[model samples]
Target: MESTEVLRISRLARIDLDQDEGARFADQLTKILAYFEKLQEVDTGGVSPASHPTDLVAPVRADRPDGWEAPRDLVARSDGHTDEFYRVPRVLE
Candidate 1:
Protein backbone atom coordinates (compact mmCIF):
# COMPACT_ATOMS: atom_id res chain seq x y z
CA MET A 1 0.00 0.00 0.00
CA GLU A 2 1.23 3.49 -0.88
CA SER A 3 1.43 6.30 1.73
CA THR A 4 -1.05 8.33 -0.39
CA GLU A 5 -3.58 5.44 -0.24
CA VAL A 6 -3.06 5.20 3.51
CA LEU A 7 -3.67 8.97 3.87
CA ARG A 8 -6.88 8.64 1.81
CA ILE A 9 -8.06 5.73 4.03
CA SER A 10 -7.24 7.72 7.19
CA ARG A 11 -9.23 10.71 5.85
CA LEU A 12 -12.21 8.40 5.10
CA ALA A 13 -11.99 6.89 8.62
CA ARG A 14 -11.81 10.48 10.13
CA ILE A 15 -8.39 9.63 11.63
CA ASP A 16 -5.57 12.19 11.67
CA LEU A 17 -2.23 10.57 10.82
CA ASP A 18 1.14 12.33 10.55
CA GLN A 19 3.61 11.58 7.69
CA ASP A 20 5.53 9.04 9.86
CA GLU A 21 2.32 7.30 11.03
CA GLY A 22 0.91 7.21 7.47
CA ALA A 23 4.12 5.55 6.16
CA ARG A 24 4.09 3.02 9.03
CA PHE A 25 0.40 2.15 8.43
CA ALA A 26 1.07 1.82 4.67
CA ASP A 27 3.80 -0.83 5.35
CA GLN A 28 1.55 -2.68 7.86
CA LEU A 29 -1.43 -2.71 5.46
CA THR A 30 0.83 -3.95 2.61
CA LYS A 31 1.98 -6.90 4.75
CA ILE A 32 -1.64 -7.72 5.80
CA LEU A 33 -2.82 -7.67 2.15
CA ALA A 34 0.17 -9.88 1.13
CA TYR A 35 -0.86 -12.41 3.85
CA PHE A 36 -4.44 -12.46 2.45
CA GLU A 37 -3.02 -13.09 -1.08
CA LYS A 38 -1.00 -16.03 0.32
CA LEU A 39 -4.15 -17.48 1.89
CA GLN A 40 -5.99 -17.27 -1.48
CA GLU A 41 -3.42 -19.69 -3.02
CA VAL A 42 -4.42 -22.55 -0.66
CA ASP A 43 -6.38 -25.33 -2.45
CA THR A 44 -9.50 -26.46 -0.53
CA GLY A 45 -11.47 -28.41 -3.18
CA GLY A 46 -13.39 -30.64 -0.69
CA VAL A 47 -13.64 -28.12 2.19
CA SER A 48 -17.00 -26.35 2.65
CA PRO A 49 -17.42 -22.76 3.83
CA ALA A 50 -18.78 -22.64 7.39
CA SER A 51 -19.70 -19.83 9.84
CA HIS A 52 -18.83 -22.21 12.71
CA PRO A 53 -16.56 -25.33 12.78
CA THR A 54 -18.93 -27.61 14.72
CA ASP A 55 -22.11 -29.13 13.13
CA LEU A 56 -24.05 -28.80 16.43
CA VAL A 57 -27.34 -26.88 16.34
CA ALA A 58 -28.40 -24.58 19.18
CA PRO A 59 -31.26 -25.87 21.40
CA VAL A 60 -34.30 -23.54 21.46
CA ARG A 61 -36.95 -23.64 24.22
CA ALA A 62 -40.67 -22.78 23.79
CA ASP A 63 -41.34 -18.97 23.83
CA ARG A 64 -44.47 -19.26 26.05
CA PRO A 65 -44.39 -17.10 29.20
CA ASP A 66 -44.00 -18.94 32.56
CA GLY A 67 -46.56 -18.16 35.33
CA TRP A 68 -44.57 -15.95 37.76
CA GLU A 69 -45.96 -13.32 40.17
CA ALA A 70 -44.11 -10.36 41.76
CA PRO A 71 -44.27 -9.97 45.57
CA ARG A 72 -46.93 -7.49 46.82
CA ASP A 73 -44.41 -5.97 49.33
CA LEU A 74 -42.06 -4.95 46.46
CA VAL A 75 -44.95 -3.33 44.51
CA ALA A 76 -46.22 -1.37 47.59
CA ARG A 77 -42.70 0.09 48.17
CA SER A 78 -42.70 2.01 44.81
CA ASP A 79 -44.20 5.58 44.95
CA GLY A 80 -45.19 5.63 41.21
CA HIS A 81 -46.75 2.16 41.00
CA THR A 82 -50.43 1.20 40.29
CA ASP A 83 -50.95 -2.35 41.59
CA GLU A 84 -47.95 -4.27 40.03
CA PHE A 85 -47.22 -1.75 37.19
CA TYR A 86 -44.77 1.16 37.64
CA ARG A 87 -46.00 4.55 36.28
CA VAL A 88 -43.22 5.88 34.03
CA PRO A 89 -43.13 9.27 32.29
CA ARG A 90 -44.66 9.13 28.79
CA VAL A 91 -41.86 9.11 26.18
CA LEU A 92 -43.94 10.25 23.14
CA GLU A 93 -45.75 13.61 22.95
Candidate 2:
Protein backbone atom coordinates (compact mmCIF):
# COMPACT_ATOMS: atom_id res chain seq x y z
CA MET A 1 0.00 0.00 0.00
CA GLU A 2 1.02 3.60 -0.50
CA SER A 3 1.59 6.25 2.16
CA THR A 4 -1.84 7.70 1.44
CA GLU A 5 -3.46 4.37 2.33
CA VAL A 6 -1.38 4.19 5.52
CA LEU A 7 -2.36 7.75 6.37
CA ARG A 8 -6.01 6.84 5.88
CA ILE A 9 -5.61 3.86 8.24
CA SER A 10 -3.85 6.05 10.80
CA ARG A 11 -6.65 8.60 10.70
CA LEU A 12 -9.33 5.87 11.04
CA ALA A 13 -7.45 4.31 13.97
CA ARG A 14 -6.93 7.71 15.68
CA ILE A 15 -3.14 7.70 15.20
CA ASP A 16 -0.57 10.30 14.11
CA LEU A 17 2.23 9.10 11.84
CA ASP A 18 4.74 11.43 10.25
CA GLN A 19 5.46 11.21 6.49
CA ASP A 20 8.70 9.15 6.47
CA GLU A 21 7.54 6.87 9.28
CA GLY A 22 4.19 6.24 7.60
CA ALA A 23 5.87 5.18 4.35
CA ARG A 24 8.23 2.84 6.17
CA PHE A 25 5.36 1.32 8.12
CA ALA A 26 3.35 0.86 4.92
CA ASP A 27 6.21 -1.12 3.35
CA GLN A 28 6.59 -3.32 6.46
CA LEU A 29 2.86 -3.93 6.73
CA THR A 30 2.68 -4.97 3.06
CA LYS A 31 5.43 -7.54 3.63
CA ILE A 32 3.79 -8.86 6.82
CA LEU A 33 0.39 -9.26 5.11
CA ALA A 34 2.08 -11.08 2.24
CA TYR A 35 3.54 -13.53 4.75
CA PHE A 36 0.08 -14.11 6.26
CA GLU A 37 -1.28 -14.80 2.78
CA LYS A 38 1.45 -17.43 2.31
CA LEU A 39 0.38 -18.98 5.64
CA GLN A 40 -3.18 -19.36 4.33
CA GLU A 41 -1.99 -22.10 1.91
CA VAL A 42 -0.60 -24.34 4.69
CA ASP A 43 -2.20 -27.66 5.86
CA THR A 44 -2.18 -28.70 9.50
CA GLY A 45 -2.45 -32.43 8.89
CA GLY A 46 -1.53 -34.20 12.20
CA VAL A 47 -0.27 -31.58 14.59
CA SER A 48 -1.48 -31.70 18.22
CA PRO A 49 -2.65 -28.59 20.04
CA ALA A 50 0.10 -27.37 22.38
CA SER A 51 0.93 -24.41 24.58
CA HIS A 52 4.71 -24.87 24.10
CA PRO A 53 6.98 -26.38 21.45
CA THR A 54 8.84 -28.60 23.94
CA ASP A 55 7.54 -31.22 26.47
CA LEU A 56 9.71 -30.09 29.40
CA VAL A 57 7.91 -29.86 32.75
CA ALA A 58 8.68 -27.20 35.36
CA PRO A 59 9.87 -28.42 38.81
CA VAL A 60 7.33 -28.00 41.59
CA ARG A 61 8.06 -25.96 44.74
CA ALA A 62 6.42 -25.99 48.22
CA ASP A 63 3.79 -23.26 48.66
CA ARG A 64 4.40 -20.69 51.39
CA PRO A 65 2.06 -18.17 53.10
CA ASP A 66 2.51 -14.45 52.40
CA GLY A 67 3.76 -12.60 55.53
CA TRP A 68 3.70 -8.96 54.39
CA GLU A 69 0.95 -6.34 54.87
CA ALA A 70 0.18 -2.94 53.30
CA PRO A 71 0.63 0.33 55.27
CA ARG A 72 -2.49 1.33 57.23
CA ASP A 73 -2.27 4.98 56.03
CA LEU A 74 -3.77 4.47 52.54
CA VAL A 75 -4.37 8.05 51.21
CA ALA A 76 -2.38 9.99 53.77
CA ARG A 77 0.72 10.18 51.56
CA SER A 78 -1.07 11.12 48.31
CA ASP A 79 -0.87 14.62 46.70
CA GLY A 80 -3.34 14.78 43.77
CA HIS A 81 -5.35 11.81 45.06
CA THR A 82 -8.94 10.69 44.38
CA ASP A 83 -11.21 8.04 45.91
CA GLU A 84 -9.00 5.27 44.54
CA PHE A 85 -7.26 6.62 41.44
CA TYR A 86 -4.46 9.21 41.09
CA ARG A 87 -4.94 11.90 38.42
CA VAL A 88 -2.15 13.27 36.21
CA PRO A 89 -1.82 15.38 33.06
CA ARG A 90 -2.43 13.45 29.82
CA VAL A 91 0.87 12.19 28.44
CA LEU A 92 -0.12 12.29 24.75
CA GLU A 93 -1.76 15.73 24.76
Candidate with top lDDT is: 1
The local distance difference test score of each candidate is: 0.86, 0.79
Q: When superposed on Cα atoms, how far off is each prediction in RMSD?
A: 8.3, 7.1
Query: What is the C-alpha lDDT profile of model 1 across 29-69, one tens digit per residue?
Result: 99999988987788989988999989999989999989666
Cα deviation of 23 in candidate 1 (Å)? Answer: 2.2
Please, what's the RMSD in Å of model 2? 7.1
Prediction 1 global C-alpha lDDT: 0.86
Worst 10 residues of 2 by lDDT: 68-77
Per residue, candidate 2 scores C-alpha lDDT tens digits across 1-93 of 777889899999999998788989999989988888986577877967799888999887879876655433465456765655665777996
Error of 2 at 67 (Å): 21
